[model samples]
Target chain A: MSGSLQTLSDFLQCLIVGLRLGSVYALVALGYTMVYGIIRLINFAHGDFIMVGGYTLFFTIPAMLAVNDKLPIWLAVIVAIAVCALVGVTVELVAYRPVRKKGTNMTALITAIAMSLFLENLAQAIPAIGPNYKIMRRMFSNKAVLNFLNISLDWTTLLTILIGASVMIGLQLFVKKTKLGRAMRAVSEDKQASVLVGINVNRTIIITFAIGSGLAAVAALMYFAQYSTIMTTSGTMLGLKAFVAAVLGGIGIIPGAMLGGLVIGLVESFTTGYISSSLADAFVFLILIIVLIIKPAGILGKNVGEKV
Target chain B: MMNKNTKLKGYLVNTVALAVLLMAFLILNANFKTPFYSVVFIPSLWQISYLIILAASLNLVLGFLGQLSLGHCGFMAIGAYTAALLSLYFERAGIFTDKKAPVFIVSILVSLLAGGLLAAIVGIIVGIPALRLKGDYLAIITLGFGMIICNVINNLPFAGMEGLSKGSAAASLYKTGLGFGNTLKTKYAWVAIVITILCLAAMFMFIRSRFGRAIESIRDDEIAASASGINVSLYKVGTFVYSAFFAGIAGGLFACCNSSLSTASFAFTNGSILNSTFIVVMVVVGGMGSLTGSMLSAVLMFLLNYVIKNVIKASGMPLFVQNLFKYPMLVYAIVLIIVIMFKPKGILGTREFSLVNTIEYIKGKLGKKAVKEGGSK
Candidate 1:
């Protein structure tokens, strides 16, 4: 009985970690799915926005913490989100807008890839941000608030889940009740029709990018807090995983992204615990391939047959 | 009969142009023992050939079939490892021991074929399910496949091993013994050049055949092509397999010439020859569906990379300037964006350059000048 209980506790512990990781993936995946919904193009650089946000915090948090040891998490979160949104909007306007106007889908796709490469290489080349890891300062103590039957719940884990749930609920309400959210939905459904009906399609798209990027910023903070390190290329793998999560949940669906993120996180955690940690990535990709093959529309995505 | 005659003439012109170019290089390599030729030009020649093969193969899928696959490097890595393992096995079996030159040539041939075949098999397996999807989904799936391949290779115990030890920890197990250290001390420039030309000819012929027309029709309109009874799925899978085959052969050549084989070499990161972005950039800049354009851009990009690296090394520039020059990918990204924005169709834009076209262009220019003079008179 004791052995079984211990095993149960271990499993539950893994679940808690999975949930924490899933929330971060959910936040980033929301950005990917939203941008993809609004524009048919996959914003390849969306992943890089997380990296940008990470670097923003990497630069800001240490200096602020040095000046005042009691810096609020909210202040850091707001500043990072603002900077990330600014960068996201700038990228959409400067790099993506012109290409979107005068090119095919292939061209736009290539441009997005180019933008990804440009951002990554530029970060590496900059003297201040050379290819090195920056250790992120801790914002809160990871002290256990609850312990029951050999299972402990930490403060950081609680905060991650609470923030994630609140943001998700808030987003759900915004999309359902707000005028801007309605405009976004209308534009995604039919851009021409939405424009005809007096929705600012471009503005809606920009706001979508802002919201997505801001969420990515939050994800970046949580990720850094957990990992305690930030690198120029850290976002690549995380972004890819979140993308898989989004696709697994049925892309362009909000709740689906959340569910998918959690599922992927659980799968990864279980694989790492049971199987070889190194092969965990391979398994994740294999799952992605299988999911794509079996249900290309994803779990919650509607299958729209091609019109002849 | 006239068409046949023109075709024959076209072949003759192309052969002569190729011969002249090869002869120039051979003469320079034979006589000019300068550091410039040996250190830079020769290596750059082989690298250019590799890139051309990669770009042309990817063009068949991306440009001709209208499918985006971002995992060409995965196939290349497959080929590289296959070739490396085969050569090592042959060396262990003691087949090519006495006569070094013949053995080297035979091993290279075998590795290329074996590597290409294996890669094609993997390609077909990946393509069957992946091809059912469209656009960005296909791209992501393919990217996932590439990463899977990289991780698998990194984790696999090298050459002779008992069991799969964890991830990249197994990298320490294998020894890459194929290239410069063991082989005959001769430049591989000529071999790469010949192989590149043959691959180009094969791709060109395939593109102009009836099957090529079907592929192009599918690209133009999938529904129309399907209506015309074209087996869309078969053609898509076939194109992908063919592309992977060539990519594998290129990988074999790269493994043989460069001699260093690491999983990182095949990753989708900056500065790796096996990177998908670099290959896509080559095809895009060269003009999609134009073999000549891909070839031209491949050579041009190689030269640009070489120049940037060398110039940075030679110049006494500021630290910041030198730092910028250290990453050629930054320049490549800028160029890619500019190309996509301004000339989305690329430098050639589905147009091929030929000796006949060049002659006709010159004659047309002369005729126009003559007409202008007559009008003036």
Candidate 2:
């Protein structure tokens, strides 16, 4: 390949990696934005749900694969999603419900932080799941399916992007076309109004958490597959980055999360590829700070003034 | 009449109480042979003092300023690394000549001040843009700033190279010591305790000052405060800088006490003093905006942590059961969650405990009873 072609391919490879990473971020960010939109509380433990999902797959996949070598990847994913959704609902109902009822934002935020800490410590305390990082069993063969001009694309990356796109589109359709989606939008816009209009507000909120957490599980599967290591505290940074993506995308807007995730993922990949890899995290945060300063409402977020 | 005389009396009483407490700590430090003093009291005292500085500094932002800053630990890290590195350099340079006592005191004081000043400068840089964002947005931005700070420290060639090979091009400037020497010995726990008391007093006085009132007004309502000519932006930035300054000092003291500094010590991960959530938990549990509450809660929480960990270690239990004790943070998390859920306003609910208030309350109750008795007669 020519030098220019090499450079182009390198850029394209980075772009591909960025999209794959961005999709996972987008999945997590969707949950974050949705929760923030409805409850005005950042469920800091939402990221821990991803960790739980990974662990679920870690434990279940190995056992099932041993019994039947031909076990489908989707079964493990389905099981993980179910487990994560249940965990999400329990967290919402138990730790978050009372704090939200109290209607104190600081309290709610602190409670969320506590939940994050609790989950992390609990995981660390558990036998065989201590503080050490565990290598994930590769469920999918990450073979390159396409190669052109010195650039190769892996099947996992393609599937990740494809799945991410499909999920985003599916979420968009679900929110736009379904009755529950309308209720979710209504509750997010005005809880009291939604309640008055005969919408089961509590049920809708639980469903939102379930859906968001299910997406997190999917994100976790993709994340562990890519990185192939799981730590109790891994979700903390991932969650923070996803939260930033949500905010970057103009939090509370669905499309914005997707866009923000892509931007963050791209920035991170380019920084790691072109600049110092050590500075990638710093660059990501710097971008967040700059984006927040330039557009406090986020890239796609509408600026709303606080009323007296 | 409740006037300057009463205020002066309150100050005098508080000073006397502080002096007595200092003397007690000095006596304890001098008598290092007692297992109770060495193992339980000294460690807990130093931790309490460190926490007081952290919790109180965070309160200035969370409570008085009504701005949530999740990156307080970032400032603390700046302080820790700066102080640790400087003290290490000074020790290596043989700056402390024969006069051990005075030199040690002066070096520690200088390193701490330098740490605080550097951290305050960073705070100003961070706070300028960060303070512009409100509420949760501000919290997340501060958090990002904190993670960025940690990442920088972890990757920087100047630090975090304790384990790396020397021949490598990225070798650090200073050798990462296993621990600080006699310079930061546990005997200096009294010094930390005294500094903590002074910081608490300063914060208490600042909150009562005109500037503090201006800051509080801004917290109450920024639009109204600005309308009332209280430069909201200036106060917001000023308060953040002030808070960061103290948090930096606390970090300095922490480095001195622990005698080691690393990016791991300052990151927002599990078991780090720089864990933003843990600091926030301390502030909230102490009751935001109340110095007394912060101090009391800090002491209580530190004791709880120390006692629980020690007890678990000493207990004659199975390996599995004993292993569960390794997660003291789980207890902290549970306590924090309970506090948030049951008593969101915190134990003191922004109310400071004062001798004057206690005296007045007793007097009022006695007078009311006397009046009631007389009426019945």
Q: Write the per-residue lDDT of candidate 2 for residues A191-294, one digit (tens) a residue.
A: 99998999999999999999999999999988988888999988888998999899888888889999999999999999998998888989998999999999
Candidate 2: docking tier: medium
Docking quality (DockQ) for each candidate: 0.74, 0.73
Question: Which stretches of candidate 2 lie above 4 Å from their native place?
Answer: B97-99, B162-184, B272-274, B316-326, B359-377
lDDT of candidate 1 over B1-377, digit per residue (tens): 33888888888989999999999977876787777666666666667888899999999998888888888899998888888788777776886654355667778779888989999999998999999998778887898888888788777766313221221343422233356432222355677788888888988888888888899999999999999999999999998999999999998877777645677777775454348867887898888989889999888888777767778868898887886778877887787788788898888999988888798789999999999999999
lDDT of 1 by residue, A1-308 (tens): 48999999989988888898889888988998888888877788888889999888888876777889776754688889999899889889998888888887778878988888888889988778888887877766789989988888988888888888888889889988999999988888899999999999989999999999999999888888788787778887788789888988888888888888888888788788778788888888888888888889887888899899
Chain A of candidate 2 scores what in TM-score? 0.97
lDDT of 1 at B13: 85
The TM-score values for the models, in the order shown, are 0.94, 0.93
What is the alpha-carbon lDDT for the whole of candidate 1? 0.82
Error of 2 at A256 (Å): 1.2
Report each candidate's C-alpha RMSD, comma-separated, in the order given: 2.8, 3.1
Model 2: residue A82 alpha-carbon error in angstroms: 0.6
